[model samples]
Target: PLMYPCRFNLSTRSIHELAARKAIRSLEGHDLKDVSEYTDHNSEKYKKMVEWIARDLDVSTLRYQTADDMIKAIGRPKENLCLYCWTGECPKSARPKAAITIDIVEVKPDATRTKEIKVEL
Candidate 1:
């Protein structure tokens, strides 16, 4: 998804998008058949490929989001969103984080004109 269409908009995207595109593009001409030949315990070839790509992309740091974090950021219920791309399994329910609250105080030039606001996060 990020190779053809998204790569076309590379310059217009944010740093995060660009990094994602770079990561996807790194696998651009790799032969999946060869990668499949290696056992899961010996993933040196795949690891090296990723390392080379990261270096080529000149990224200071790269991190892949976990399935849980991705779901939380999406905000939608787990049943409503697609997780195949990340987890390869569909979860029936989501474990979202509890809501947070903060208090904000605003003060005007007149000491008497002060307002307190409660913000939910």
Candidate 2:
């Protein structure tokens, strides 16, 4: 089984609340709605809710593990493991300092021109 622990934030809580409310309403036979009717896929709220659910599900086909359980199974020092998603505490070195750009040139054998590509890091 694959295990990936994660920390839920305000947005996740909000989605859970929304789902809960919908479930409760359906249970009470009041204003029941289909899952597709919850929100438009184009909306930011819908996107966030989907992302939250995916994260909560660990985007995995296998069983899940809790943060503490994963840490214990790893048998490595916590400092060496990246647990930012689970603990929400990122080490200083792991944080990005700034955006970096690199330019690459691609030359074609059949053409006289070269293409330049800009990549951001």
Candidate 3:
């Protein structure tokens, strides 16, 4: 199986806080347990723990495609492709400067007649 890293603009701290809250809630009936440690979100240990959890959750949530995979699938060069969806970085040349519209015409041939359809983009 191929593994691709998940990339998005979500906040990791928010996810960690939510998970920590859930953990604390789950330990409500436990006896002699120090659950106060889960509330420390700024510690290095907490950051590492949450990073692993967040990575696992993020990866399990979706199947991601890398920029190389997208380029190969679309048969386009990386320089000419807008890969902002796959990778967070966008090339300056790929940015759109103005809006453009295109019109397309489809022709259908029948036994004794022809039909024309016009489409605008």
Whose lDDT is greatest here?
A: 2
Off by over 4 Å in 2: 1-63, 92-121
TM-score of each: 0.33, 0.27, 0.28
The C-alpha lDDT values of all candidates are: 0.37, 0.38, 0.36
True-structure RMSD, every candidate? 13.9, 16.4, 16.6
What order do candidates take by lDDT, descending? 2, 1, 3
Q: Write the per-residue lDDT of candidate 3 for residues 10-118, one digit (tens) a residue.
A: 2222322444434333444332234334324555544444555456577544333344654566554566543333233444443445442211111123432212222
Quality of model 1 by C-alpha lDDT: 0.37
> How many pairs collide in each candidate, listed in order?
0, 0, 0
Candidate 2 lDDT score relative to the true structure = 0.38
Candidate 3 TM-score over all chains jointly: 0.28
- Colliding residue pairs in candidate 3: none
Off by over 4 Å in 3: 1-62, 95-121
Q: Pick the candidate with the highest TM-score.
A: 1
Give the range where candidate 1 is weakest over 10 consecutive residues by summed lDDT. 1-10
Distance from true location, Cα of 6 in model 3, Å:
16
